[model samples]
Target: MPKDQKFQKINFDLINNLIIIPIEINGEELTFVLDSGVSKPILFNLSDRDSLQINNVSEVTIRGLGDGEPMKALSSKGNVFKLGKVKNYNQDLYVVLDKEINFSTSLGIPVHGILGYDLFRDFKVEINYAARNIKLHNPDLYKHDPHSKSQTLRLSIERRKAYVEGTVLMENDEDIPVKLLVDTGSSDALWLFREPEKGLEIPEKNYEDYLGRGLSGDIFGKRTKVSGIKIGDFELKDAKAAFPYRESFGFIKNLGDRNGSVGGEILKRFNIIFDYARGQVTFKKNGNFRAPFQYNMAGIELQHNGLRYIAESIAGFNGVVKSEEGSFGNVQILLENKTRLSLVPEIIVSGIRAGSPAAEAGLQAGDVILAVNGKRIHRYKLQEVLKMLNEKEGKRVRVLIERYNKDLLFSFVLKKVF
Candidate 1:
């Protein structure tokens, strides 16, 4: 907790490429995403608000990517946000009043809100993806290692989002200089905005699909692969990218001049150090640095459910075995010592794209996935399962599900539609 210490270590939860951190707000401990793309800390999806003491509350309207209308939120000032022993007073936060969307379910953990640019502005942050830890250093006393092999890139801060210059390989094999936002909050590898001025257009072989879920609603976009993306001396080939329709951007259209965003999918390949105070970001490649980017071809969206167990009556059927009655039950378990229990992750079908493999196979929303390709769902993390579904075209996938207490088997083959 000492301010003069070289760096303060903070443990984090890495779920589906998103960084979730624990912090205290108004003396209450809550989980928040460490997002560099957001300008200020924002709180949302809290069912109970009267319990927290938030000062200077005012109604506000905010717009974000997606098709839904502008969200109605509450703005508050003078709130104490405590990260470890470090406390920031009089901080500003935008609290969403509407509770229709809950990120906790999708993230597989409770996410009270997002902590953004303000945190990086106050300290130098070093994120080790392999170690799942973050080190916070005082800018005045922090010093970069002279013998480190990490590459440092100059950053352009616009509206609190970090942007860097990179080269994108077009269909013609020409490298186009592009300014990309370093967005750790986004799951995709890269997102190129279609701007006429920049001569940016959708790739010839691209499919229209759901990009992601935004604060407002579903974001529809084009999914495609670029020949490569060059960041400094490192070049990543066949990177999966998204191009959200212009209308889906809403108010963000007027924010800045940038070609696209570089998201966690690409950033995860490196151990990143964000030195906002110095206007520089450093990166060192990890073991997954060369892994090829892939998209979900199964066409089913999944959400994680915390530790759960199959009911005693349904214990005999372990997903692989066929059930005579086709009925199964699941029970949520409460553990006094959660650490003693090895967590077995549960996932449910949240959405299915029309005409896609999963949809054609009769997969529907609310189906509890018990297994994928004969492997138990608990054996893999949410991201792993997603990658499996998106693996290779013509690959057969057999999914077992528990729907309304009835067990059902679904099978499909991954295909490239674009």
Candidate 2:
């Protein structure tokens, strides 16, 4: 392929606000989350179904957002990474061996790894989130569009990660300037590190919640909403926010001069551009900008537990023909296809916050979810199931689960916590 001015426009899977992109490693196709906060790509959750080849490996341990211990991983320097026909011949990566750190479960997909800085450093990237496609423009040939309506903002590249400055509305709705890391990896709206001294503190009305998974372990925090967040001329109102417990900060050595991070929950609201070499980011409002912020009303986190096969009966083209009692009567036929087993995803509750609706209703971790609201769990995608739980405050929810060979039912009414 020629060194063209444009890279292939790749469509991505948008799950829980995070961008899941497909790429090739040593000719093996795999899915990865495009994370702007990570400096180097990391590979994990490689199940038996995936095949990959890595060269020049060395043992290493790394840590991130999770509260657990540093994860054991291997570093590899020689590998061919491909996005469509574009190639990076010497991609460096860290491969985690621990099966417990797999993201496929939480993502409800086969997520083999994460891609970050290495992909962004060399090109002008454009993400049309609403349309769900990305474009990589050659820096030398790419020029700012003359008719683009997007407003440009200064982007700070520090420690091989990106940061942007924005204003956060305090309790009284007074806007205060703060620096936030641009984290596309996190599904939460905002993550404010508590700095009361600087006027940034957990909102008084917030509730203790399980924030999300970090590199080192699970992150715990309080969930609340800020009055708004301002970047450029746009100020989003009542933006959801999370204040992760400081103990979970171990994975990241330093918070630096920044207060917290702005995650995909907020970023997905706009079509954006990332110009790493130019030290800038541009944002234009997308259709999702005005969508109301919602939390997991059921207070349950789910993950895929692998797959199970079940027999399914299907209709066949051939039908048995029968004569009617009278010569003029129409003929009747009865036929059916053979029963065959089909593989379906098995989902389970991974975590439930204490005192939340699900917990109050007796939902437990490790329960194999059989159905949600009378619908088979396999019939809906993970996000669709999440939407059902958080459909509305006061909405009643029913769930069926199998535990210890016993099927149990649970019900709860969604409640507004903040």
Candidate 3:
């Protein structure tokens, strides 16, 4: 280890609006989401094929976003954690044993865990969403990147989570000042707690949608768009927003004075730096700053079911060159591509909004998606498949699914909601 090194930059994956990083726990490696909203390291999604050693486990009950009952989890203490050359000993983390609480299917990758707070507290973290990498700088040796347009906002760290100040421009031409949680783990843009008397009102033109999943269960809410938001010198217009029902995200209402949260969808548009040690965060515009928000308009949610064999053909000579005897000089050579079947991910329709186009077209929840618009879904990632469906409002989608050992075909047009 060098004492003069300024920072260590680690490349990360920006998948489905979430940051995925490679981290090691007790010498075994796993992928984790760097969630600013989550305070501690929580592990789950371990299958029978995964073998890892976790030390010191005790059962406990914890609750989060969704409306489900408190989840039972095991708290593991005194473990080693590593990322790049950074190391911490005797770290404490919680592990969920529920197999159904997995994000690998929805994300098209294994999301074994989520970690935050500790990392931000230990280093001056710079997240360049446009660059798809993170820089963990030594607190003592930290230096801010030169940016004339950047603004540093005060970070209020309470209960191991960070919050920022912003103003939401409502549909009625009201600028409502708010204290929003900076939640990188959430994929949506903004989530405003509905308090009509306080000038925070849900627009009349909104639709009920699946917001995301939390510790408790799946969170459903009303989705809409606010006129804009003012954060420092920047203003984002027509930002996609969601109002999580008080019933689903009840815990958020209890967080002292927090009006809502600025999620990854908005955060990704800026290059940000989180200096938890100094109680501040910096924001600067990136390449995605002006990009319009894209939403899933097909009204169907897709998830990984399992794996199926897909045959691929490869060209190769079929004859043995040196050892083959043509039996009197008549040579028969067959040169054709050989067919090879290999395992690939299979996608399934997990949910369909009632009254939406997919439901009208007869797409069931358990239907395994085989192809979409004449393209095999096995060759694409979940996000890629989503892009295919969400490309345009009037895009027609043809889907082939296997249900009850029967192949079924369905067609639907992407209709705009709200």
Candidate 4:
């Protein structure tokens, strides 16, 4: 029999992907994900409380990816957490109470807690999202790359009305200094602002005032192209950004020390060394990291109504022509072309926004949209449907839906906007 391959010893010196660290809450050891996106002290969910013997409870208001009111959380202290060689024998760690902390998935675990900048400020940290490793060092003694120069500058997050000192490159400068979040969970492109005054910018002159979600609540943002950004010795121009005009201040204040985050989008494009033991991150701008893409465009900004992702896309071969249809929501699917997909859910016209297109067509909330142009709505996405509608502007099309579980079909004309 062939010998079994021994699992590599857990490397505390470098944490890539997810690592299980021993944390003692009230003398009981538990595990949590080390996340930068968490924005605060250690947080735990309601499910993990019983096992950890959390005996006390406090009403703490916490925010997340939606517009729901602040969530109440439980808190405690006398907790001991060990990361690699460093140890926090006793500290006050906050625990967030929620049955299922949903929004984004972790490396597989149920995202128990996050260790943010509080602890990181004590050490120099480096994260290589590409290599999947996080290294810590002492900031005072860490070595700087010969090709890189460091300067502490101010960054203003307009929504938060605050600024922080961040280190960036002094070369290939753009008028807008790249504002970043030192987030570890974001595996996407950098978010840029369009209206430098509003501190946001959107391409195609479109703005989604109610579209945004991360560790914060739903945000208003604009979509636009980023020619690129540079920091230290690295530069990523021609990148795309989802410039959100709003966000929660908790995180902004916490990471106000770093200009913005140096996320995977730009990190993957370079070789980085973070000596958190010392408090510095260095990047060598040379690597093959492509930004996340959506149909040649770099991203697909979207909104959700609880059950689905709602958005439009350009249609047909020339990118001309458009239609509107309900793409299945949130659920994943595999397209006929072997591409992976997130199918939109079945949507009947919910409440139509006042004075919107549907309302003018005598379409009201609760109207079911069944089919378009006599063809059964099948295998089409939200963008494709919108494209079809745009292409057939001013033309009448038949729509079918089930209201009160009764199948109803009607005709509506697409109107031209702009």
Q: Judged by lDDT, which candidate is best?
A: 3
Residue lDDT tens for model 4, 194-313: 344533334453434333344344544544445565564345555544555534334333533233444444445655544433334555544354543221111112222224332333
Q: What's model 3's lDDT at 313?
A: 57
Candidate 1 structure quality by residue, lDDT tens digits, 1-418: 3666777789997777888999999888888988878887888767534577788999999866678899888899999998887788889999877776667767655678888899888888899987989998877778888336679999877777789899998777878899998988887789999865665778889877888777787788888888889998888988788898877777675746688899888998989888887789888888879876766788888886545654323323333432231101222333333212223556899888888899999999989898888887665666677777877999999999999889899999998865
Write out the backbone clash pairs for model 2: 65-214, 65-215, 66-214, 66-215, 66-217, 67-217, 68-216, 68-217
lDDT of 2 by residue, 270-374 (tens): 999999998999999999999989788788988777676545454663444434331112233343555544456777888897889999999999998888899
TM-score of each model, paired residue for residue: 0.86, 0.91, 0.92, 0.52
**By how many angstroms RMSD does model 3 differ from the true structure?**
6.6
Q: Give candidate 3's TM-score.
A: 0.92
Which regions of candidate 3 are displaced past 4 Å?
Answer: 48-50, 251-253, 311-339
TM-score leader: 3
Which residue runs does candidate 1 get wrong by more than 4 Å?
48-50, 146-148, 253-256, 304-310, 313-347, 374-394, 402-406, 415-418
- Model 3 lDDT tens row, 136-160: 9988887776678899989989999
Residue pairs clashing, model 1: none
lDDT, candidate 2, at 332: 35
Which stretches of model 2 miss by more than 4 angstroms? 146-148, 309-341
User: 2 or 4, which is superior by lDDT?
Assistant: 2
State which candidate, 3 or 4, has the greater TM-score. 3
Decreasing lDDT order of the candidates = 3, 2, 1, 4
Runs in model 4 deviating more than 4 A are 1-33, 37-39, 46-50, 55-58, 64-66, 103-109, 138-174, 193-200, 205-212, 247-262, 271-280, 290-418
